[model samples]
Target chain A: MGSAPHAAAPLLEFHDLTVAYGGKPVLWNVDLTIAEPCLFGVIGPNGAGKSSLLKAALGLVPIVAGSVRFLGLPLDQVRGRIGYVPQRETVDWDFPVNVMDVVLMGTYGRLGWFRRPGRQDRDFARECLDRVGLADLAGRQIGRLSGGQQQRVFLARALAQRAEIYLLDEPMAGVDVRSQEQIFRVLAELEAGGSLVVVVHHDLRTAAEWFDRVALVDRRLVAAGPTAAVLTPENLRRTYAGQLDVLDEIGRAVAARGRTP
Target chain B: MTAPWLSAMTAPNTLVAAGGVAAVGFAAGVVGSLALLRKRPLVGDAAAHATLAGVAGGFLATGRRDLPTLLAGAFVAALAALGVLVLIRRFTRTRDDAATGIVIGVSFGLGIALVSGLPRWGLAGSGGLEQFLLGHAAAITGRDAAVLAGVSLAAVLVVAAAVKEITLVAFDAAFAAAGGWPVDWIDALVAALVAAMVVAGLPAVGAVLVTALVVIPPVAARLWTDRVAAMLMLAGLFGLVAAVVGTLVSATRPGLATGPLVVLSAATIFAVSLVVVPRRRQEGS
Candidate 1:
């Protein structure tokens, strides 16, 4: 299935995707096609299956049905071309690994079995750390870092993967404003370098300002397109449903930004 | 054949037993560190307790009661117990701790019943099977030591080869899986290595407390360093010292089993590290 008839097939595609946990469906029929390299934001409320969508695409969660394709191929065929940074809270910060060791892990996928990361890989990892402004903290144990530093470290590791398509789950969650700006700067650079950057984000204020395109999701896709077109008041009301406070704030953020939502 | 230098030493049998137990200790520490890092240290305990039944099963099946035959059985039992653990977690609503407890209870009880009943049933060569419960390092022959050392070497080599992958999966399994790394296979490899080390540890540390060999040194080593490679090496060194010291001490004092001595030695190291190291201060920062 490596050969797709259409040369311009979407960079990433979720064909009628569904995800379930313990036999309960959390995400359903998420048919989204990201056709270009852009800063794509998956905006949703709590428990709206935003994380599940990314996890399902990564095959971390059980996909009850449907399929995910990268570059018109199944995951195994194009895995190395895609990089992922899971949620910051998904790992133990106190694990016996320093920042450099964690970043070096990003090279593991390319290194394959039994091959150690060499000097070139180390140099590249250091460069990735530098990109996230964490070059000096490379020797510090991960737990010693603040929450923002930890998030940046995760981002650096993903950057070390050096893939064409980047999927980051809640990269800005619990991060300080400064670190948030640094991460977004790096993501913007990634986009400028002609890479697809899909971020699972929660805050609509930044989602409105940052992402070029956004998908409104609440278990199912409400709408997806250029950020201004997709973050419409009706879509926000539909996706957030009972969460009126969030909708109101988001509406104000959109209007204040003057994005013609 | 034993090493030329080892054979030339006084009391060659004791030296062999010590050497073999040392290797087993080193391997256990290395393997146990991985298990501890994986946050499934108790899984080794479950595999350890399940080994006795395997020993009994081995003897009953082959009736030879040789080290190779019995250890082969113990290895199978350890894997089986681990398999049951995976099955329970996968198919049932039982929590991880409860499932581990169940495996430990059922397997250890079955082992005790089997070993206790063997001699009573008039089975030949079953008289010494109970020694496996608490270990009988004194009974280790040159051949047994060689087999133990061989198994230990293989287990250590596997760890060395996969240390990076193991550390990767342990630290952040979600990232590893998302990057398309075979997290499940790597986890299974670690479980299998733990089982192997647990089975190899049976002759020196015994089924009842062999988990200590695979646990205590790594834990103590953790107190000394925050690096995985350093922790692994220190744990291995600590295990070797404990095993050699315990075996040698037990040799000098008749009627004392080597298993308790080894565990005590390891515990002593752990206790000292606990009190002496500034781990709390570092943790606070």
Candidate 2:
């Protein structure tokens, strides 16, 4: 199903994708496709396998069934064309590396092994840092940065990858308002530049305002389409009400829909 | 600093011994730092402890205690221990800490039993085998030193070549895997290097505490630098200094073991760094 005959294949596609951990499925039969460039959101409540979807696509997690394709090719064939920003909590920030050292890792995929990043790579990394408003902090240790600054550093690293498809997992979580705005702006720019930016987001209000297309996922994908059509009250109820314990929080997210600016 | 020891340092054998131990220390530090960054510091410890059994097995199999033969056996033993660890993790319900503890206790105990029984069993040429328990650098031959130095140089060169790839996996394995880097192979390379260093360190630091050879310098270096390249260099330097100091100091005293002295010197470096390096950096968490 992922390999179509036409040249104009979808940018990214997850066909009958199922992700499992220890023999138990977390995400089941997710058939989501992004045909063009856009700011796409994977919105879900806590424990809804939102991150799992991205992990499956990146081959970080084992795909129990089905396959994920990027531009009609398997993940390995198109890995160089994709940039990934894992969650901030996924790594130890106290590692003995400065910001510039980390951002240079983005160029590693292209550089291959043994050859060190040279003058050109440094200049490009600095430009990436500049894009994320972190050029001055490039020499500082990653641990010394604020939460928002760290997230921005990660964004700069992803930008340094120079990829056409960017998959960011919870890039805005725990970030200050200014950092979130800057991140969204950079993602919007990527979309405008004919790149696809897929994000795993938790906030409903921002999902409606920021993403051109949003897929509400809860273990299985609930609804997916344009932002206005997919984020209806009925879909939100179905997505959020799966876990009866979080009903109050679900109601709050639903009630705040009108207040979305 | 003593007159007798300073004079002894001029002796060709003493110089060779010190040089070999120095290489082992430097390589251990370089390899150990990568394991430390990977958050598997104790993995080296497990391999270090297992080397004792290998030392015993090597001597028993070859009927000779040459540095290369014994270290070859030790390397095989260390790899076997790591392989067992992987099996446990893959097959059993045991936690990692518990598995590590199991490997250490069982391997170390077997080593002590074997070494102690060698003399009682009347095995020929087993008189000095007990020296391996806590290392005795005074007995190291020039040939042994050359072998140690050779292995150390090789380990260091391997790290120098792959430092970038190793650092990437250490920092963000998921990102590296996503980028199509062979993360498992990199991790395996690190493990194999650690085992080699542990085997090479068996003569100078011994099996009981050789883990310090790999662990202390990297940790101490971490306190002094925020850069990975600088950290690796500092770690190698610290390990070299500690190995040289321990070997030299043990030379001055007849019965003193080299392992404890080496560990103490590394501990001193760690202590000084803890006191001197500022803790003013913000906590990232």
Candidate 3:
């Protein structure tokens, strides 16, 4: 009952993806396709490997099996075409760096290493910060920022990448309403720019209204299509009320809510 | 001739040793700040105790009472201990704290065993090796102080050249890796810097707890500043003050050890700073 994807080939594809932590598998036998420039959402319970899927795509986490492609090409060949913003909580805030310095790091992939960040790099960083509404706070230390502000800084760094595809993991996890609105607006603008955007989001209410398409994932791909159809009552019941004692209740609720239909 | 205290401190050779110890403190503060910020404050703790085995090995290998030759052996042993710690981490299921504990306890045991066995083996200068535990800076020659200053200078230079990379990796390893920065190598480089500073500090703080020489000043300086570069400079200044004062105080108490005195002074500084300096306010920028 899903509408056909756009005629154009998928910009990103994951083929028979499987990932494990230690010895046991977390994500298993997953195949996914994203076509055209759209806001694609991945909704799942806490252990559903939504973040792992993104990590496997970026070569950030070890994948036991699977092949991820960008524009039907291997990741390494199209490395410049992608940008990733990992979880905000993943970094130490107490580090001795300001917001602008953190954002400038996003350009390092294109600029390469051992070379100092130049004036052009600063200009690009400034542009990205301004885009995130962080222009006035560029010189401030990141530790001094609120949780929401730190998330915006992470978004600013990703924006600095200037890639055609952006992968964001829980961009709204701890952000305040204003910062969340700021991030969502930026994401909406990216989608409008002919960029393929995928977010591993937990908020079902927002996901329903925000995403044009979403993939409902548990240990496996439970369902996927437009947000409304993917988030059917049956899918919600199976996702939240399913006999998954290993999963957290909040994760289940979030997964159930992220459904569009 | 000056006042009695000034004249006493003016002894030309003593002046040189004090000056050298001050530089050692400066390098320790700089390197220690990096370690502390990286949350690896006690890594030097492992290197510090392991130097005892090296000191004994140095005397046994060269059959010399010369401080440099002994310290050279201690340096090699300390690096080797660090190597062993890495191997343990890679090859075993033991936790890092456990591994650090093993290196600390066993190497120190080996050092004590070797030193105590010296009398039975009729080895010359075995008795004097005990000075390396607490330090005998008074016994260190004018030339030795100059050597210490040279090593300290090299450490400062390394910190200056690699500040950007070191700061990046220390703050966020994953971000550094994502940026295609050599995160692991940068981390290893900082570890190497820490080792160099620990080795340089041995003649001043000695093997038993020279790690404190690196650790204490940075702890003191953290209370006073938020910026990393400023913290480094302040920590170095604190270390220099501690070293000079401790050396002077030890001179007055003839039999007192210089290393412990220096460390105690640094501890006093740390306590005062922690008490006096208010925690910086958090402002979400």
Encode model 2's per-residue lDDT on B129-236: one tens digit a residue. 767778988889988998889999999999999999999999999999999999989998999999999888888788888999899999999888888888899999
**TM-scores for all predictions:** 0.93, 0.94, 0.87
Q: What DockQ does predicted model 3 obtain?
A: 0.29
List ranges where model 2 is wrong by over 4 Å.
Answer: A1-6, A244-261, B1-5, B281-285
Evaluate every candidate with DockQ and list the scores.
Answer: 0.61, 0.58, 0.29
C-alpha local distance difference test of each model: 0.90, 0.89, 0.82
| TM-score (C-alpha) between model 2 and the true structure | 0.94
lDDT of 2 at B124: 82
lDDT of 1 by residue, B37-137 (tens): 99989979999999999999999998888888999999999999999999999999999999999999999999999999989999988978888888878
Model 1, CA-based lDDT: 0.90
TM-score of 3: 0.87
Query: Which stretches in model 3 have alpha-carbon errors above 4 Å?
Result: A1-11, A71-81, A241-261, B1-5, B91-93, B279-285
Residue pair clashes in candidate 2 = none
Candidate 1: residue B272 Cα off by (Å): 0.7
Model 3 scores a C-alpha lDDT of 0.82
